[model samples]
Target: MINMQMRNIGIMAHVDAGKTTVSERILFYTGKSRRIGDVDDGTTQMDWMEQEQQRGITIQSAATTCFWHDTHINLIDTPGHVDFTAEVERSLRVLDGAIAVFCAVGGVQPQSETVSRQANKYKVPRIAFINKMDRVGANYQSVLTQIAEKLHLNPLPIQLPIYENDNFAGVIDLITMQYLVFDESTQGATVIKESIPATYLTSAEEARTAMLDSLSTYSEEIINLLLEETPIPEELLISEIRKATVTRQIVPVMMGSALKNKGIQPLLDAITYFLPDPFELGSVAAKKIYKNKSEDIQVIRSESDDFIALIFKIQQDKESGALCYIRVYAGSIKAGTMVLNVGKDKKERIGKLYRMHARTPEQMNELKAGDVGVIQGFKLAQTGDTITNGAPILLESIQFPEPVISIAIEPKTIADMNKLKEVLTILQREDPTFIHKENTETGQLLISGMGELHLDVITTRARDEFKAQFNLGKPQVSYRESVESSSQATETFERPINGKETFAGLTLSVKASERGSGNKVINGLSNNVLPENYQAATIRGIEAALSSGITLGYPCLDVEVTIEDAVYNEDLAHEVAYQSLGAMLTEKIASNASPILLEPIMAVDIEVPNEYVGDVISKLTSRGGIVLGMDMNESIQIIHAQSPLTKMFGYSTELRSQSQGRASFSMKFSHYEKKLS
Candidate 1:
């Protein structure tokens, strides 16, 4: 039986680094499946989505359970594509540890570095896997060296590959001083426990010594013992390894060719022995609500003593209605129990508990601490909502990156309008990064995401899952406008009727602000000229005017506006008329200040063969890109640059053709920069 103390982990990697193959091998060896699923055939159990099968790439993170050496292991396989980075981000939020995969031939790819940075951001302890050691040009030693030099990680190899290319057979475990050989005909792993392989003894000993030397840094006593040439206790060494892993001081790198089933058992053993459990981290961070004497609520941290759970993901099931996935931090949650949603300030009753298996779910009665499970009929629970058993807890919400690409979408026929609305609403709820907004001025429904693939997946989901037909326009870059310099303007609106005149006047000033500071309105009118309520109405009007820009009808940001003076007639003063007049004055001032268009710029990191670096750089520059820096290691070159989103509409196809399928790039929204004349 597997140990109950075991916690869940996630495996993340860049595209085409054999992450799914590794997952498949683990499932096969653990007896969860009778046969392994191959990514080449699009039959991987974790990537069951139709879009994933069609594209042969994982679009959503997949979760599964298995056993390794009497320890229960819950593994979540995350997407490597930059467009679906939200999947990796959400998975890391709940995972206790991770296996970051890097290809032996490619070493650390661009997306690999991206995911590594994300794991570090979440403080997730990780182990490295150098997969595909049997492929041509595969060099395990070079990849391990790259992990230390390029990614800035202290990677100690626990197992050494015995052969390369077609001769690859097994691996030698440094800790156990044993050799594990794979019998392909029997599809089973055999351990040669009696003696070490003579061919690998020298390299294995060197690797073992290196492992011991690295472990010694975690403890002075171990270093002293090593210096004195005394034998260190195995238990003490294991304890130090566990401690170093939990503290994220070192990452253990292992090599394997999952396709050949070589080195699989050793990798599983390392995971069970080296990875840290959730309880080892003491308590997950959360926030609780405290009621003050004034009947107001305040947020407080709840580490372990409080009952806290955060809703990380939510799905709409066709048969079950809605399923909310939650991660419990401190306490157990039972089915049919009432819990408070501190974020929404509402109460919800859990209908049923389910242990997730990718798209399928297994029914359960309860979920304990440090467990991830799904609850049905949580109407008030959102992606970032907090659930509490005792007092209400208001935890920090998850923040997603902004969308960089956008397209205007409309229903093909009037009959499909209602369906489109329904589909878009559901898609927005499911994907936090997708933004669907109705542009009232332009009469367009704009959908935005990280890139073209991101938006394409949503449209595919709408058609396949929701049965909705829609028309999409060419992708467009989402942009904004702001004032270039400070200026002031005064305007008056007067109406004369029956020889009597009603008048309103206002003076406003516009000033530039720091980038991303957004728009702000300050009211400086005296009470004698305009009442407080009228001043408030004027401020609202100014905000409305600024939102629908004075140029190109885009949103304005990084600017400040102040209403310096105002004149109003008490008899003729009306909220609607005063607000309308203020709106006109704000627009007048904005036009006089000379606004400039600010286009979205993306931070792009590309990894390609050294021979193709020149072509990639030339193509990027042709698209108005500015090269920030270049890094070269071994046979690949990594280029970092900034490019306008408007110039990158079809760059993906160009990049693929330029590198002949030997390159990959990941880009995210960096900032907005003014368009040069």
Candidate 2:
């Protein structure tokens, strides 16, 4: 049971929805921690990074292993900010299931919706937790309605909140028809089960019946029992609910306030009872190649199958140098074994393996198929590399968003240059979306990330961890250039190189691609004329040319290039000349291709008091934002809009002032649109 009993899950939520605090409670309750850790005081176990502690927010995903009811739970706590959404994306890619925490008052916030959509894209089964129920204005019914309307989820309540006036005492289980309350005297350790309180008996019975009726579709036995008015047993109901949960047909909703230390134990029980195990996901899919033919197939999760593990994350441990985290899918992995990184076509040796709890590493000799563990000394393995013992079977890699904001940074002292480069290189390897580059023309070093906080974390680490002081410049939006019209051009490379004239003629066509598709290079020329090696070189050059825009120095995007025809002599043909000509001809074609600038547009969600709704609307209007929709939830107004990133660099500070510190908001990348002149 220790091997297949494991459940790989993540706790996801919006900012300030108590995701970290809930993680601490789970760790403490499951004996992973001696006492609960607080995020506000910077004592949390999951938010262990120095930056996270100082800012009182989670920036990276932390993984840990604990047990409850003889079931091993491998949990990952992910960041809630939109800037660090890639963290959530990668976590969901490997997890078997998730617990999406929603604030009862601020039900279905922006980031909550964003992460929910991310989970849906991966087909991850999840349960809903109505967190912060202890706070005032915690309307459970409103949040449930929003879940159905906004998240498009089929939600069923498994528990009903028992509130004594404004204070939340406990919850009544709808499945077993019992009242369960946490003991405050024992610090929520003792659970007392008794008869349903007289005040909530009517509502509880109605809820229990409704829950059973909805789940009848999953089990024929339950349907027959309900139709016959027979008393259904608890096991029968739970089994049917588990069936629906594993299939992701319905999301079972539970309520709790993690900050108050109430309603955590039941949530843990729900996780063990409902979420899927690695073995239950049946077979893991991987792309395998045989005889130069590739197909997508499933790899069964079993100890008998060949070893397959995916490197989901990479961190630079202070004492261990490089620490790699992997989810074992097919077979067991042990220390002192060699695995091939099928994506890189390189072999890597597993040195020492460890199970990581936050930043702490515990040495382990082996890990089972469903477990998560770490390894070190993988010099060439990247974040998404697939390591396998069998033939080259590559797992589908995680996709990351491109960086849209950048800033120039330079060492304050010349002695810090090498250290700065080394530090940034390590940071780049850790986060795929974090980009590091140097301007050859001006000799300026620049780092690009998703947002201001992302860049701030990089600079702070450079200063604290590496002790490399640096001066940073102002932030700038990373605009893109795109083709606006179809055009054709022919260029003949008849230049003299090394006292020998290298002549090659190439014709190319350019057209505007759909927005958000990035750039593409289509080879319309016959292979006999252009050949394979030269075509590859030309594509590389086209990619290089797209990095610098015609309107400004920004990168180009959403454009397609086609190689119409080319003439080259095999006796004197060189790939190097075509590479240079490719970059050269791309720029020549852009001169008349009607290039246009595109700026990153963000979808913004704001919640403010009704009194400040007018002010918020006026400010967004001045910043070139159109109000997408507005809704009222009690006294607060929810406003959504699409605004260009250029005008939103420092809008947070201004928004706090506009709403008198009562309004808050979050934004995420929506689409890239043409920038107005």
TM-score, every prediction? 0.87, 0.96
User: Which candidate has the top score in lDDT?
Assistant: 2
lDDT tens digits by residue: candidate 1, 1-677: 43565757889999889898888888888887778888889888888888888898988888877877677788899998989998888888878899988888878877887788888888888889889988777888888877888778788777777763467767777777777677777665554443577867898889889899888888787899999999877677767776788788888888888887876677777777778766767544445455542233433323344557788887777789778888777677778898888867788898999987777888998777777788898766678888887877565667677787889899999898888988888888778888899887676899999999999999989988989999899998878889888888877767654555656677889888888877888878789879877787888888888887886888887889999998788886666656776788777778778789999998888888998988899999999999999877567788999999898888889999999988878887889999784
Of candidate 1, the 10-residue stretch with the lowest lDDT total is 293-302
lDDT of 1 at 363: 91
Query: On residues 1-677, what C-alpha lDDT tens digit does candidate 2 reach at each position?
Result: 35437889999999898999999999989999999899999999999999999999999999999999878899999999988999999999999999999999988888989999999988999989999999989988899999899999988899999989669999999988889888888778788998999989999999988888888867799999988999998887777888899898999999988998888998998998899988888687789966666889988889888899899999987787889889888888889999999888889899999888998888999987988999997999888899999888888889998898999999988898888888999999999999989988888998999998889987898799878788999998888888899888888777767766676668888889988887889987777887888888878887888887755777888888888888887765667677788888888787679988899998989999999999999999899888999978888899999999898888989999998899988887788999887
lDDT at position 310, candidate 2: 90
- The segments of candidate 2 whose C-alpha lies over 4 angstroms from its true place after superposition are 1-4, 289-293, 494-503
Question: In model 1, which regions exceed 4 Å deviation?
Answer: 1-3, 164-166, 188-194, 290-306, 487-511, 516-550, 557-594, 607-613, 633-636, 659-663
The model with the greatest TM-score is 2
CA lDDT for candidate 2? 0.88
In Å, residue 592's CA in model 1 sits off its true spot by 5.3
